[model samples]
Target chain A: MGAPFNYDVLDLTDEQVDAEVRVFGALTAAVRRLNEATLRTTVDHATVEEVRRQVEELTARLEKSMIPDNFGVSFTKGGRIRGYGNAVVGIRNPNAVPLTVVQDKVNGRASAEFELNALHEGPPGQVHGGVVALVLDQVFGEAAAAGGSPGMTGTLTLRYRLNTPLGPCSAEAWVDRRDGIKTIVKGELRRADGTVTVTAEGIFILPRWAREEIAKNGGTPPQFE
Target chain B: MGAPFNYDVLDLTDEQVDAEVRVFGALTAAVRRLNEATLRTTVDHATVEEVRRQVEELTARLEKSMIPDNFGVSFTKGGRIRGYGNAVVGIRNPNAVPLTVVQDKVNGRASAEFELNALHEGPPGQVHGGVVALVLDQVFGEAAAAGGSPGMTGTLTLRYRLNTPLGPCSAEAWVDRRDGIKTIVKGELRRADGTVTVTAEGIFILPRWAREEIAKNGGTPPQFE
Candidate 1:
């Protein structure tokens, strides 16, 4: 209602930006706490119900500041956040399905872990194969991003090593090499016992559009941390 | 119940194989008809509604053969007729998601088309990006499989060029090359106006498991054509 929408420019009020950052930090902390509980506790039916209620409350609060259009990530004065309101990787929402990315910089390797609850399961007792791909894609993309080149997904191939269990699980990805426009990254998912569940490798391309966007914004390209 | 359950393979008399074959043939023919109609028509609300009714009726008949477990594709008796029954490419049921793939062998190119009906859509109005990836992966994998190797998805990467229209759309995939264990394939989706919507590429691997499975089954891999 404030202004007509145009793709040319992204406008965010200072208050909106502050609110988004606060919400994102809260969400990150909440997910971490929930994940910790899931990993540490027995997590019976009652616990699951309690967790669900907490998630619902979080969802309600996040809905208030929801932007009508998909919001892109921004580096504010502080570099604490990225993609605050993006559809897949948005940080400022209860529904933002976040993936925890851990990097082994010395080894040039990286891994990620997340517990998908009822919100993520696709098959009856197994995680949806597509969901597995979604997580793998993000994890692998981030792994490549961490490897001095952040590229968009060009092609990803996954092998279903086994039917992934729907409960607590972990995933890992690491960089293979850089070949021209392609950044090859390898990734895998596993149960707590370390059974190789799904193995994947991806070729991410430095997209022309994203590069143009970076240039237009007067920003240097993102580099490996 | 005529035999406890309708399509229990254990209960199916030898004679029922012929009946099953006939029924399957009819279903295939019906799917072909639907495909033809889809190509010929604009597929407006009235058209979709009409088609939905027909789909419902056909689905009911197909559901009559409700086996206890999922019906995986099968071939026996010297491949007289391959059971595309459980193929994820058929149009009749929700399970296969009914992909329409067309290969231009003369040009060594292929394209696939399908609709994201009420069942498949995750986000509002826009087709789920993951669903788009699923169809692309299947078609791209099949394209690689067409080129002698018969590989599985080793990696797939997609760039969401645009929010794919919820209604009628098309997908295309082509074999790029083979490098050792990786068969490189490229693919895309487009709207009716021929605008390139989504672009994808995948590295398909000729997994050791599939090779062994083919050898155990004996003879050439079942011809996809």
Candidate 2:
């Protein structure tokens, strides 16, 4: 809303996006491995300090090479950001479950598939309840966006039907209704057995500034596909 | 009702926990800085590769010193895990917003304070809606636990009153009611000005196995103080 939500499509070709994806994807995997290492490492005090020193040196070297302030969002027409820099579905985020989302514009639906590991646990053997909510919010938000009514989340309600085990899972969402600039979306997270683990409903609203921008821009909604 | 929820407290001295917190806290901060660098770096492809190689080498070295399989939860008799290795409030987790939670045992209430950074952003300038849900779940779960009835989240409902800007925020939760083993908790996320950004109500259920474990262990509810 403040800066038109940065909807301008970046001028990047498919090949370029693919190349960036490959590189960033690898980097993301490395981070994931590093997280696991952090969780499972039990080195002695001296070794831990040694490792820290090495990492700090590397961090210092990288600090010298930086972009201007502000990490701009990269929006491509009919494409997701292939770089791992994306917060929701970015492969580079060790915290991310790295859902691969797909949108069906004709059906006003969105879905994603991912697997949670020990890294995402809450109560021992189960996936963290907060992680389930996070995934549902992302999927439902995508559904709202796919319905040609991109908006910010106004409310999200989740009912955990079962303890989502720490393993493979899938999620889907669809627009249930739309009222003016507000869209309601329904979504769920399921285990590999197709048993629903969590169900969610969310209301998304186009902010006043965004609504005005759309009106000024000839009433064109942001495209998800 | 699967495996008994791991509520067993570990026998660690305060000094030991403090040492772990210091070490892991430094590591977590470094990883957070690295994440920012990864997002904002504009170095040449070769340079990026070189940096990746260095990280990969460090990761490999750490991998050689593994600490068994699971990352055990650090639970002391009367203390929260100060180490950042905890999934929710752990400062060691670069992905975590690292909420500092406090529970009023007498009041049956829980409160958390945190600051969401660019790493937790979803909208152009707003905190990720999912992150809101995640924090609410944690706060509410803590509230339920603080109410002398520790349990797992069964449902969490959230109403976003506004687009929570990415910055300093706080949340609080209190027990609303209790039904058998289920506890209902109400909570809200607020800005420094006391503007409520999101409100939540969650149902937390003490599973059958956990109930039995409590009964067998003399019916003492897990302490949250």
Candidate 3:
């Protein structure tokens, strides 16, 4: 009947949104470095313990005042989105593969070029297969949104053809077609050399609540995952 | 024919492995707190920048003398593993949901009890669907390994039956059967109250090299994903 929850439309200037993106994006990048170091570090135990205490103090400083809950998708009066907590592309999520997909609305396509480092390994040097799925799900969702019929991921299928090594990689997805309320999106994961490693297809459907809302109120739904 | 990259069987003792786990695991836990604060913090920009500088300095201290590359699965002489870089269960990986999966080799099953906080949110208070798949993939792989047929994931299929609310959750997976070199694993994600929210099936295949090594050289394969 209505939105699920927390898709708040806020009153903020475009400049304000851009500043949040910049400041928070930088913080996320720094935290990712700390994440990688947490894995790869060979510092002495004393130094590590010291760093832990320092980290705890910094975290406490930030936690002095905080949000009540998750940073849900927010839209500005100017239509700019602050979906910064997304698991795939969330600027604030260190756990993210941390990708930003470019949506080409005219062609119903989405693509992103990013790097997978030591933090993303699965079979030794290769990227974890689930991480690939995480990135694909978001990209495919964006493609559905770009196609002008946004929805939730109904089902995603992936075939691992080869190993995706830890390094620079790219992904491309486009809407194949639409079937009633469903949009079928096709995509592939590629190595830096442009060799395909995984191919995926997903069916995204307009949720019944959103569909009912649209039928009753008559407006396009939010174009986000 | 040999193991892929860095699954090195090291010469460390159980005590050494235990100490490393304690230290690195603590570091990861601290980093995770910083990660959450990075998102939830509402302090002034000056405070954010100063915290960022401190984080960078701490990370640098840890990275002084680090491993050359990915922390591939390593085994101690006493039989404990240092797969601390895993995405789902890696204790050293802050990006991980950081669960400690318990393997029941006798029953060819594996399970874990963990929590998903605001960081794992997708649909407002609900856990992200892709995050659900990520957890299932790891649990299914462990089940295959426990069943005495470790392998890479060939294909994983998931069905989201209901929204898994953010908070405490548990996952259980077991070997349903084996088809030649392939092990079929089935699992489900449950909310804190034990309600099933997502179901999954994954096909894990012992790679050709490992299979050939066993067939030609005559021994069981490694029992770890």
Candidate 4:
């Protein structure tokens, strides 16, 4: 890799970070519930319009009362605050499947548990094939980053072996190899019954810009462990 | 790969499909607005809790009055009725980026246009890198299917060329080659100024089970054109 991952720890306590993550998690859960309701709601047109107006007004009110920008990612000595507004694993993103992941650096592996609700469906009863790709890519990237090299995704390859059914699913990934600036990771999504649904391989690279940014900031990147 | 694409005309007017698509598009747009607001809102704790409760109550009411489940994909004679509840491009999915895609079979190519809002952010002021993968996979799959080889994704490789900004972006994909069951498609996501942000190549395979399912059901598969 161009340079080792590094980050300067912030002076935040673990308790504070946990509380923040929990609060965001609650909000995301509520929003997810709302999203599903929106998809399946079939109320009369009048009722629908009324509810829409109320939601719009609420949005306007909140906008007027809230901060103007996002509180991007933050780091602390404990680790990279995992609950930053990440689209993939952020507890604050209602769009996320909100996978709970465990990275095992000693074993050079990472695993996640998640459920694909109706919101993720593609085929009538199966998970969207593309969603499968999305999950696999995230897990594989995590695996690559876990191996002491935090790099941006250079390439991701996936194989759909079977239709991933909607409901609980598990995924696991591991670093298969590394070549200087390139790190290759392999992973698979599996059903509860251990039936493999999708398999993936990805190549991650430490770009020059990322290296320069890390160097300029004088921050140490968090190790996957 | 497993079987050639096939389809039988259904009795559906283009007007009917367009009308339905538009209706769903409006609903998704509303939901998308709600999602963005949920992300950026920063009201006081008391007000936030109050709004959350109200949203919850509304959700409960809607649940009692709405449809029981999603109205999965539907096919029509004019085409595949591309506006099905697809997780990627379906107008019915509030979670989707809602890319507007046009598959030009006459030229053996496919392209899409979409915008990423604050909700899709990963890094500060930038579109989430995983989202780039998500969009590319869908476009590449569309390209493979556009070439008359409507298969599942076998493998997809993406190269991040530059940071995709959080705003209007366009992507295009085309078949590079085909080998029996495998179709290779190449694509790139570009900024409004035509700066290439990410490039990808994917291999798609028509699985044996999918071929059998089409044969069992009297349903004809939609052609890419």
TM-score winner: 3
- lDDT of candidate 3 over B1-225, digit per residue (tens): 123443567899888888888888888899999999898888888888889888889988988989877777777778887778877778888899877788899999999999887688665566777888788888888988888878888888777666677789999999999998789999999998999988888889966754664566454555664
Task: Please report, as a residue range, the 10-residue window in candidate 1 chain A with the lowest summed lDDT.
Answer: A1-10
Clash pairs, model 4 backbone: A5-A221, A6-A220, A6-A221, A7-A219, A7-A220, A7-A221, B10-B77
- Candidate 3 chain B: minimum summed lDDT over ten consecutive residues — where? B1-10
What DockQ does each listed candidate score? 0.05, 0.48, 0.57, 0.41
| lDDT tens digits by residue: candidate 3, A107-187 | 999999999877886666778888888888888888888888777777777787777878899999999999998899999
Q: Candidate 1 lDDT, tens digit per residue, A1-225?
A: 111111222355566567645544453434423322222232233433443344333333333343433332334443434443322344432233455567676655667667654334332234545567766766776788777667666666677765565567888888888899888888799986788988877777766765665577676655322
lDDT for residue B191 in candidate 4, whole number 0-100: 91
Q: Which stretches of candidate 4 lie over 4 Å from their true place?
A: A1-16, A65-71, A76-83, A222-225, B1-24, B65-70, B76-83, B223-225
Task: Please report, in order, the local distance difference test score of every candidate based on alpha carbons.
Answer: 0.52, 0.72, 0.82, 0.70
RMSD of 3: 2.9
Model 4 residue A13 lDDT score: 83
Error of 1 at A46 (Å): 24
Output the lDDT of residue A156, model 4: 73
List, residue by residue over B137-163, the lDDT tens digit for candidate 2. Answer: 878888887788878888788887776
Model 4, A1-225: lDDT tens per residue?
A: 112233335887899677756665666687778777767776665566666666676667657754354435557877646435556676667777777678877766789998886677665556777778777767776787777676667777777787776778999999999898899898899998889978888887766766676677775543422
Error of 1 at B168 (Å): 11
lDDT over C-alpha atoms for residue B186 of model 2: 93
User: What TM-score would candidate 4 get against the native?
Assistant: 0.87
Structural similarity of chain A in candidate 4, as TM-score: 0.86
Candidate 2 lDDT over A45-97, as tens digits, reads 56666767776776776678875433435566656653344456755555666
